[model samples]
Target: MAKMRACRACHYLTTENMCPNCKSTNLSTSYTGIVVVLPGRKKGEDPRKGSYVASRLNIEKPGKYALKVR
Candidate 1:
């Protein structure tokens, strides 16, 4: 199986050429770590503000995210 590609803009990982999360074509294969954000759990609180991992990655919405996209 091939590794998932991470979006450069949102760090969202996907197998498709176009990122489903940010709809960005800028994707990279060089990424490290993965984060799955659960819905209805951390509602109202911005992941880019409250959560340490999400904050560091600048993730605003709840979804699968790459810890580091390079």
Candidate 2:
């Protein structure tokens, strides 16, 4: 299995030490839950828009993301 790392900045999950989305060095090995965003039908709008997951998680980009970091 591949190792997982959570980004402190954006909660993005990746195997790399550095977060690909935010380029933040703050990474955590302990995290829970995962959320994925799909492309929105309208321009300049995200599919996750108005979703509690997006607002509570502070997610702006559409991709695989972690819910929490510990």
Candidate 3:
């Protein structure tokens, strides 16, 4: 498996050079904790609105994310 890097801008985890979440180039291999946000059951419903972690982290989409990125 390809090692995942954390996005410094949005904390999203990706394997690419740029962050697909925020389109930021600043990525870090040093990060702690992982959170997986799932999409809402209904279409057009945002999981962020209902998820405590997502709301606290200000995540706009559902995906794997890092708790902290250095």
TM per prediction: 0.73, 0.78, 0.93
User: 1-70, model 1: which lDDT tens digit per residue?
Assistant: 7679999998888899999987999999999989986553556667666577776766778888788889
Give lDDT tens digits, candidate 2, residues 1-70. 7988889888998899799998998999989988886546676675457567776776777778888788
On lDDT, the candidate that comes out on top is 3
Backbone clashes, each candidate: 0, 0, 0
| Model 2 clashing residue pairs (backbone) | none
Candidate of highest TM-score: 3
lDDT of 2: 0.81
Give me the displacement of residue 57 in model 3, in angstroms.
Answer: 0.5
- lDDT over C-alpha atoms for residue 17 of model 1: 95
Task: Give, for candidate 2, the lowest lDDT window spanning 10 residues.
Answer: 39-48
Error of 3 at 30 (Å): 0.3
| CA lDDT, candidate 2, residue 49 | 75
- Per-residue error for 26 in candidate 3, Å, reads 0.3
Candidate 1: the clashing residue pairs are: none
Q: What is the C-alpha lDDT profile of model 3 across 1-70, one tens digit per residue?
A: 9999999999999999999989999999999999999988887677778999999999878999999888
